[model samples]
Every structure is written in structure tokens, then in C-alpha cells.
Target: MKYKHKYSLTPIAIAALVAFPTAALADGPYVGVSGGVVLPEDSSNAGEFDADVPATPDFGAIPAGTEVGWETQFDTGFAISGQAGYAFENGFRLEAEVAYSEYDVDTHTGLTVGGANIDGADVAILTRGAADPANPTVGAVIADGQGKVTNFGLFGNVFYDINTGSAFKPYVGGGIGYQWVDVDYMPSGVAVGADEDGTFAYQLMAGASFEVSDNFEIFGQYTWRDSTEEAEIPLTLVPATLGVESSQSIISAGVRVGFGG
Candidate 1:
């Protein structure tokens, strides 16, 4: 059994600065921070056994190496970010940001052996490497344990503050970045197998802000990001890569403070 985290309060906003943009807030330097909920899409073909497996007591033999696929389902998670940038009087702004996010695994889906789908204890048997004389057969212990995906990212962004009249303002922008994706999973046994790597990534965002004064503004936005390549997580016993790509949607709100001209 797993305890999935739930978010009852909706996100208030998200923000990004662009090089060629129109904006408001402050004319000089500013810093911001935000936190919110994250929902990760299901991943297909996350990874596979890099080599051939002879046979296991729980499941039969599998051949053709990479054709053996691994898919996964994930529960809702959380995300946070901090950024520093300068807003121009002309409305264009450029900034840098760092963010982190995590998701819990619901189950390992779409595992197959000899053209038939395998699940429950059978999936664990193969993942725990039943073929290995060192590992005994693991019966029916799927998702009774733990698994998750963790990510760290850094980005250079641009945003434009749109003129909406009064204290309310809307902004839109995007950026390019790098991501470190990590996977740790143990579906069938007590031991855990993990893998992590870095990749090229990018995101698009939009949000609105309300100016409370000359130096402070409250804001929120929705952000979507994806990796150019898949995350390959290789583990022992499993003998395969968990090929989940780093992708997520974030709903968040934060405050920005400006100083100097």
C-alpha cells in the first residue's frame, strides 16, 4: 500500500523572463521563489533489460533484449523554484532559475514475457532477477514497496510583463535548460535499484502578478517542461534501464522583491 500526497488548494501563478519582452514590476534587480503541485504523465518504454534473461520461476524466458519494455504509472507530486533577474523599463527581462520536483510511482505497467503481459508478483520476480542463482523467487510483492522519480533543473529565461491596467498584470515566456533525472525503485523486493543522468531540457510558461507596492509583487503561473532525450535508469537484478523521460506540469505561486533602480 502507498500513501499518495494530495493538493487541495489550487495554484495561484508561474513566471519567466524573456530577452525580447514587455513587462512591469521593478526596473532593476529582483529575486523570487515559488512552490506548488506537480503532475507527471505516464511513461511508456521507460527502459528494458539490456541483455537476455534465461528463465525465472515466476515468469518464463525473454529474448530479443531491448524489445522487452518497461512502463510506469505515477502519482501527483510537488515542485519548487527560485530565480533572480532584472526587469527592464521596456518590458523585456532576462533571468536565471533553479528548480526541483518529485513524483511517486503507482505501479510498473506493461511488462511482457513471450508476447504476454506480466504484472503483480510475476513482474517483481523478473525485476528482482529470479534467473540469478543468488536471488530467490519473489512472489506477488508488486508496488507493496516504494519507488519515485526526482529531478533537478537549471534554466536561463525571458519574460514580458503585459499591460492589463491597474494592479493586475499577465506575463508569458519560456527558456532552455538542463535537467538531472533520478529513478529509485523497488517493486518486488527489499533492495532498491537506482539510476540518474543529465539531459538537455526546455520549458514554456505563463502567469499573472499583482503589485502590492513599488518593491513587492505577488504572482503565480503554470509551467510545462520536457527533456530532449529519455532517462535511462539501469539497476541490478533488473538488468535494464528505466527509460522514463523527464516531463511535468507545475502550478505555482510566489512573491518577487525588487531593489535599487
Candidate 2:
């Protein structure tokens, strides 16, 4: 009798075979680009006085031996980034990225000279006068010296993909990187001028991706990044130091294209 040897495939084994193709299609090498609206936080200790600066009469009430300083704010800025990475079938990814960002000065405030607050004036006037006390034109233009702060960076990042067994994947990740962005915007006009560029940095992010095709996805993300060190740039017009520290909040969206799994 040709009756036969009974044949059986377990449920788990059958399911695995059926799911193999989808798993393979879901992970691979990918590249992405994104843009963001950036909001920058204020940095303190923006300027300080030292002995080399003459106690000039041009600076109103800001004599020598006065510690020069101010706080700052930025208008809404923009950021762009590009990255390449490999995604594993087990739900992990590694990427390398390059990014750039820029912001326009909104205003300067909290002018403290010799530890005294110079209130009731446009902070720009105070900063300009303090920087170039000899220039009588200083402080007249409330809108003068509208400078910008810019950034360039390289980063290595790692991410964990939360697989929902469907078209959507949510993720959380962080990275450590280096930035070349230490110039002081207020002084840049008189001085790209106030700076000590390059510092260690770090960031944290949360995002979600929607698959547009088997090998393509669109994502939205929110990130917070900060420089781990303070940068001090020597003032060109005066005997003073401009101290800058950076922190930012970003909301962005991008697309990723994938290759072989």
C-alpha cells in the first residue's frame, strides 16, 4: 500500500516560513534627510571685562574694572540633516549624520556692567557701545548688528525600532557628537567674531515612521540637543571674553529610502 508516511509541519514552523519574506523586506541599509524648526535657549556670561580694556568715557557708566555681561534670545531658526544607516531584522539601527543650523538674533537683555543691571534700553545698544565705546554711532540704532549664529556637526547615533508588526514603527534614541558652533552672534558683526568653536555634544530623540512602500518610510521626530562645554571667544574690539553655551529644541520630519535587507 502506497499509504504513506504521515507528514506534519508544526504551527510555529509554518508561521515562521510565511513571515520570513516580510521580515526580510522590513530591514536594510537606508539613507535619510530631514529639516526642522529650531528654538534656541539663552546663554549667559556673554561678556566680561578685564584690565586691558581702557575705562573709556565713550561707554556710559561702564568704566574699566566693570564686569561686562548680557543674556540673549534668538528668532525661530531652521536645521537640516542627512544620515545613512543599516537596520537589522531584530529591530535595531546605527547611523552616521551631518547637520547644519542657523538662527537670527532676536534681542539682547540683562546687561550687567560691574555687576549692575543696565535696564530700560535696547540691550543691543548696550552691547554695541560696550564693544566699541569709541563709536559714537553705537546705541542709536536699536536694530543694529542683527547677527546670526550657525552650526555644523557630525554625529554617530543608535536607535531601537519598535516593531508593531504593521506599517508603523515608533522609535527612541540618543547620540553623542561634536559641533563647530562657538561664535557669538551679537559680536559677529563687529567681530563671525565672538567664538571658540568645536565642542562635545549630545542629544535625545523620539519619533515615529510610516511605511510608504516596502523599502520607503516617512517619519516625524522631536529632539533636544545641547553642547557639553562652554566656549569663550576673545572680543576683537575690547579686552573682554564672550562666553557661549548652547541648547536647542527641534521638531522635524524626513524620509528614508531602504536597500537590501
Candidate 3:
């Protein structure tokens, strides 16, 4: 009887040890840093310009036979963001993210004609830094003597994890959010092209999160948004004509860190 009792106790001890390791590897709470390049699937609208004002000193004067063909182009910059998330035992999770990226578009054309085209011939030609509401007159000109537009926003997401037993896990998620933007158009002989305006924006996002360790990993994502801004500009020199409007979508990749159960 004594020998049988000892044998049963031995099996129980072995089972307890085997189960401990598996429990230690499961999910819990954590914090991390995620950063990468942001590439939007839809173009972000920088702003618009519709001014029939005189040119400024910088642009001199309107040239004879001068025509305007303006465009806005986007660039690829860096993205850095921080996020916190929770994973439930059933593989469901919710996350809130705040990411900031420098979104910009360049304008290459803003010309005038049948005028003097003097030393300040390029005056009233709107460029990147025209978003200030100091001089309302300039703002009015860029607005086609009407209105202007600008683009900027914020977002959030939800997802479900795939159970693969392996150390590596992948996730799919979707998000929605809003943006606050500003546009300005100021007129100055010295300042030339100027503008100011603001708006509330929106967007949608989809991406995958990678888990490298129990505490860290990397991810890549794509986002699409509706971005539009308006500004005003005025000319103090020769007659001026301005046209600035365009949109772009961006793409990016980055890494993340985790800290939790």
C-alpha cells in the first residue's frame, strides 16, 4: 500500500511542472513605441487659391503672354507615434493611437500675363507658407476672392488576433478619426503670396501588427483621408492670378515596443 501511494504522488508532481511554462507565455497588458513611413492611399488636399488681385514686390508684375498652371505634390517624411493596448484571453483587443506626420504638398506653377511683369512680377503667387490669417485681403484673393481650404486630422482602431501556437502572431485592424486644419493668406509687398484658413478632416486606416517578443514587435500600415484647406492672398503690385489645389496618399513602415502580461 505504501509503494502505490508514492507512485501516484510522483505523477502529480511531474504534471504540475509541465503546465507552468505554458502559462507564463500568454498575453497581458503592455505599452510600446511604433514608428515608420506613412503612405496614404488617397491624396491629401493642401488648399486652393482663386485671387484676381495685383502682384506684389516679390513677384514684380504680371508679364505679357504670361499663363498660370499650378499644382501641389506630396513628399515622404518620417512618422513617430506611441500606443497602448490590451489583449483579452479570447484573442480580442482594443487600441487607441495618436500619430503625427508632417504632411505637405509643393506648388510649382503660379504665373500671370498681359501685365507689367516687373521686378515683383511673381507677386501674389501662392506657395507653401501662405497659411496665416494676418492680412484678410491676401486671404480673400487666394480664395478666388471667395474661400480657401486646408487638411489635417487624428484617428483610432480595433482588431482581432490569430491564434497560431507559434511565437509569431499577426493581427488585422480598422480605424476612423478626424483632423483640424488651418489656412491663411496675408498680403504684403515684402511678403508677396500669403494665406490663412482651417477645417475639420477625416480618415480610414488598415494595417498589421507584428509581435517579435513578449514585449516588442514591428508593424506597417496604410491610411486614406479626406484633406482640404482654403486660404486668401492679395497682390500689392501688378495684376495677379493664382491657382493652387492638389491631393496625395502616402505609405509607411515602422516598429513597436510592448510591456504587459
Candidate 4:
């Protein structure tokens, strides 16, 4: 008679089965650095000056009610960021990050003085006599500007990683923070500037990571950042202010190192 042998998991096999999942989903602290491109959306209503102001007695040949409109076109730029965070066994993480980026201006158009679109002649005239007491061209419109915009931000983020029981994991996250933005408009011989307050900033993120080792991984992500704030730009010799708003998007890749799970 052939006897049937009882089959069961060995002690080591049982221990391995119990510990595998926990080891795969290790909890630990991590730090990372990323760099990529910054693509900014249109900056609408960047600046506006009153088109209905009377010329001062001291200013010569300066017309009243000259409407000057300025809009900014942002070119793609570079972004770099660093972050530190702690991940939990349930695939949740919390982190703090700081990032910086710079974008070049594509064009600065829509300048009008006394209902007449400003041209190269107008700019030349204004440049020659803008500050001349004997020939003051105060409140003259100067357009077709170019410059760079720089942004620095700090954020607190929360994310959830989707574990797939493989080497690849996907994640979605969001963050809220503060950003400082500076806009510098250089119109050959004129200076018009605007600055954003240390205002509320927020972002949405989605990404995937590939585990190369037990404590190291690489990730790529897309982030949409919104950083609109009330901005005021004082006009030259005018009692009016211009308002601007800003927004941007980014894509990046980086490496993360985990410690002490």
C-alpha cells in the first residue's frame, strides 16, 4: 500500500511568505532631486495703464487717455527641485519640496499712446526726451519688450503610491505652498516691473517609479502649477497700476534614496 505523505510549508517558507509583503512595502525616509523643463501658460492682462490721463504742465507733447496694454508670452525654461519625505507602509507619503525655474519672454506687445499704437519712432522719441525737463515726454508708451521671469516655491505635498507587486509603482499627489515671482520688462530704454506677493500656490502631480534596488528608485512625473497672485506695477509718471497673473506646468525625472525602513 502506498502511503500519502502529508505536505505542508516549511518554517522558513512560512516566514518568508509572512515577511515578503512587509519587506516590499518598506516604510522609510527619502530624499530626491529632479530637473526638467518648465512650460508656462499665457500671462494675460500682464499690465495696463490708464488711457485717459491728462498731460502734466511740466511734461511736453504727452497726450492724455493713452491706453497701454502689455501681455507676456513665456518660452520654455529649466526647472530644478529637491525634496525630502517619509513614506509609510500603506504607500502614503508626505514631503517638503523647493523648486526654481526661469522663463524667457517671447514678446511684449500692445502699446498705445493717445489712441495711437506705439512704434519704433515713438520709442525713439520717448527715449531721447523722457527725462528731459526742457523736452519731457512723460507718460509715453513703450512696448515690444523682452525679459526673464524667475520663480521660487516651497511646498508641502501628500502622495499615494499604487503598489503593483512588481518593480514599477504609480503615484498621484498634490501640494499647496507659497511662491515668489518676479517679472522684469526691459524695453530697450524703458523699465516696467511687477512683483507677486508671497501668495498661495498649488500643484497637482502624477508619476511612476521604478525600483532598481531595495532602497533606491527612479521616477518621472508631470506637474501642473498654479501661482496666480495680485500684482501691481506702477506706471511712469502716472497714478495708475497694472495687474498681472502667472501659471506654469512642468515635467521632470529624478532618483530617490530611502533610509532606515
Clashes of each: 17, 1, 61, 4
Per-residue lDDT over 177-205 for candidate 4, one digit per residue giving the tens place of the 0 to 100 score: 98887766665445666444556789999
| Model 4, CA-based lDDT | 0.71
* Winner by lDDT: 1
- Please report, in order, the local distance difference test score of every candidate based on alpha carbons: 0.74, 0.72, 0.43, 0.71
Which regions of candidate 3 deviate over 4 angstroms? 1-28, 39-70, 103-105, 110-153, 182-203, 225-259
Model 4, position 78, has a per-residue lDDT of 87
List runs of model 4 lying over 4 Å from the truth.
Answer: 1-25, 46-68, 112-144, 194-196, 235-239
TM-score of predicted model 1? 0.79
Model 2: colliding residue pairs: 184-194
The model with the greater lDDT, 3 or 4, is 4
Best-to-worst ranking by TM-score: 1, 2, 4, 3
The estimated TM-scores of all candidates read: 0.79, 0.76, 0.50, 0.73
Candidate 1 lDDT trough over 10 residues, lowest sum: 13-22
Cα-lDDT of candidate 1: 0.74
Expressed as tens digits, the lDDT of each residue in 1-261 for candidate 3 is: 456544345787886655433322236655555556544222222222234434554443334335432233344544555666776677776666665555333222232233322223222243323434452433233323212234444556566766665434556665555544332222222333344323334444555655555556566666554444322233323234243332324355555554455
Worst 10 residues of 4 by lDDT: 135-144
